[model samples]
Target: MTTTPRRYHITTFGCQMNKADSERMAGILDNMGLISSDDPNEANIILYNTCTIRDNAEQKVYSYLGRQAKRKHQQPDLTLIVAGCVAQQEGEALLRRVPELDLVMGPQHANRLQDLLEQVFNGNQVVATEPIHIVEDITKPRRDSKVTAWVNIIYGCNEHCTYCVVPGVRGREQSRYPEAIRAEMEELGRQSYPEITLLGQNIDAYGRDLPGVTAEGRNKHTFTDLLYYVHDVPGVERIRFATSH
Candidate 1:
């Protein structure tokens, strides 16, 4: 008998940032030699890289998680992961709501999927919501498009908007080092990626949390500096970004 190359299906909801996170996570899985799947029920691994920007979006994740939870009960080998904001906000409580889930990790944990899944394979369910120092970008994501890509220049948020819970859930901002970002851009160029949209909950706030040099010998860092650093990377045709107030 032959086994499959562990298939994964990701159901994403919410905003452009979530969509981009899904792609990057997908890219990470593909590099781990997993194949993509369209049906969550058929996949050995089902990842719901969800969002909780609205009440409906959060409730919907539970409903959808319900169906998969049932499937996992019937298919003991099935691996189910709940990722992104909902996982961040609810944390381990998500497991109480759906005890069948094998992993619950937040959005900031996207790049660490492989290690977390390994823990799951060892018969330990995992929840990685506690704040962590952002790792260097090394994993090659199985990018979704040749025409466009989402490059996260920063991880997490610090805004602490009164109406939002992101800063608490995502933790403090940790910008990717300038050299590593350039290296990734260069790799994307080699892969023929034509465009890259710089992603962040606050794109305009990219480097505010990091140390930097200034024209007047003052401590200064801005998203614009990061932009100019990557602006001329080869083979990239276009660049766009967003900032949420």
Candidate 2:
């Protein structure tokens, strides 16, 4: 008799940032030898890369998690994970609400999915929400589109808009080095990707948190600088940006 390979499904709800996070997480799962499943129920690992931008979005995630949590009872080996904004905002409290969750991680922790899942494989429930310097994105993203791609030039938000949860969930602003961003874009260009979108919560403020200034008292590493730096990447025909506050 032969056992089937473990499969994973990710249910994502939110903006493009969340979608980008989901792709990176899926890439990590792929690297771990898990295949993608079109249906959540059929997969041995079910992950909800949740959103809390709206009250109903948060409630919807809970309802979905409830179903999977119940399913876990019948399939004891099933692994459940809640990641992205909701995971960051709720932290350990999420584990209290959904005891079936094997891993809870924030958006900033996306690159560390492999290690987090390893802990889960060891029979430990993990919650990683503490803010840290954003890690460089090295994992190959299982991108949703071959024609276009979303590149996060900066991670987290530094704004404190009273009505927004992004600042709390995504943490402080940390920009990726210009060289790193260019390398990723160039690779995408080589792969025949036509367009790339620079993503951020407060895109206009890209390099504010970084340590640099020009003689004119202006930040030397602004988004405009990034644009000029990457405009000529080999085969990339278009460049765009989103989520400016």
Candidate 3:
């Protein structure tokens, strides 16, 4: 007997970081041979790459989860995942609120999508919210734009601004090695993506956590230095970045 092919739908909510995370996760799914599906109801796996920056966005994730949780009763084979900031913030409470969820993973775990789903396939409900030294991204993102792409130079934020929930949910600042950043851009350049956006929760805070210092006591890997490092990538005509402190 033949088994039905698996399909996935990823609904992303909030920020360039979350969108970037969604693209990476989608790439992982594609690598695992899952086809993309437009309709959440028709997909065998439904993933919500969420944001908890605002109260409304957090509430919105629960609303969507409720509908999918109900559907899981009848579709026992369906896999439901809550990933990104809200999942990081809520943790196991999300599982308590929606027991049908197969995986509750944080933004930091986006690169581990395949491993997490393997546990789910084995009939296990998994929660992976603990902080970690983020793995260097090797997955090829399914970029939403043919002309533009997002390259994450950094992950998380160090600031604990009273008004923002970013630091609490995204954990501390972790910068990707400059070599990896340029390599991703180089690949994007070869793919004919002319414009690339370097993404981060706090774009201005790019290389503080990384170890390195210039002879002049300046950070060797500051965002300014990074800009210069990847400036000459072949085929990429323009570069942009996100929110600043």
Q: Give the true-structure RMSD of model 3.
A: 0.9
Better of 2 and 3 by lDDT: 3
Highest-scoring model, TM-score: 3
Clashes of 2: 0
Question: How do all models score by TM-score?
Answer: 0.92, 0.96, 0.98
Candidate 2 Cα errors over 4 Å, as ranges:
1-3
lDDT of 1: 0.82
lDDT for each residue of candidate 1 in 38-145, tens digit (9 for 90 to 100) = 877779998888777788988888898888878778888999899988899999998898999999998878879889999999999899998888787567666667
Assess candidate 2 and give its lDDT: 0.91
TM-score of 1: 0.92
Tell me each candidate's RMSD, in Å, in order.
Answer: 1.8, 1.2, 0.9
Ten-residue segment with the worst summed lDDT in candidate 2?
153-162
lDDT of 3 by residue, 80-164 (tens): 9999989998999999999999999999899999999999999899999999889999888998989999999888888889999
> For each candidate, what is the lDDT?
0.82, 0.91, 0.92
Model 2, position 145, has a per-residue lDDT of: 96
* Deviation from native of the Cα of residue 5 in model 2, angstroms: 2.4
